[model samples]
Target: MLRNIPPLLSPDLLYSLRAMGHGDEIVIADANFPGSSIGPTCIRADGSTASEVLQAVLTVMPLDSFVPDPALTMQVVGDAEAIPEAVTDFQRIIDQVADNPARVQSLERFAFYERAADAFTIVQTGERRLYGNIILKKGVIV
Candidate 1:
């Protein structure tokens, strides 16, 4: 076991995160997300909530400083302004972990899905909450 690494992050997930370059994105998906068919490498964090996964990932990966919105969440259908509980947890985690505070933007459902499909990897969590998925772009270590 490695010191300081979140146990929820399995070897494969850690490897994927390490492999990603600046600007590459990773998705922390809910139980309902269609991760397997999303066309990117997928990692299973079964039994972990999306908030847990997001926190673990952010512990090691820095949020992109070059983008206006390095963090993106899926908007609730028909309620673009609605913020789900899981997303609120995400924002709190970002505030605590990110080097610079980053704003979490809401994307239309399909647009979020399309972005996930293009991510470097998707870590599917067991969170049962609606709209628990979040995408994070990697930032430079400097």
Candidate 2:
């Protein structure tokens, strides 16, 4: 019902994004991510892929400018240097939507989970690809 909001963003998701302040993080998790069990507030975007969800979120939220890597992705297990297709798509979205040059950083499996646990909220998406989870830190508008 909102004028410029992405239709994919539900009321709860939109409210969460608006409530978050600078430096707060939100996780756009894949279908396999244990978002509910990790303990932070979890929102469901089960009809969209992680990439789709990421694109929509970046349209309304600004990425942290104070940090070197405000975006973090889960590293592929057993292959720390490998970048999955989902991660590639994430980077592409950031490049397209972010106001500044930003790149996605890889975090080890457990490290990524821990970070997600600490996030202000987690948006669990329907993406079926492995290593599709990404964490985005909020930044000031100015």
Q: What is the Cα-based lDDT of residue 22 in candidate 2?
A: 95
Please, what are the lDDT tens digits per residue for candidate 2 over residues 1-142? 9888889999999999999999999999999999899989999999999999998899899999999989999988899999999999999999998775498998999999999999999999999999999999999997
TM-score of predicted structure 1: 0.98
Clashes of each: 0, 0
Taking all chains together, the TM-score of candidate 2 against the true structure is 0.98
lDDT digits (tens) for residues 19-110 of candidate 1: 99999999999999999998998898888999988888888999999989999999999999999998998999999977766989989999
lDDT score at residue 13, model 2, on the 0-100 scale: 96
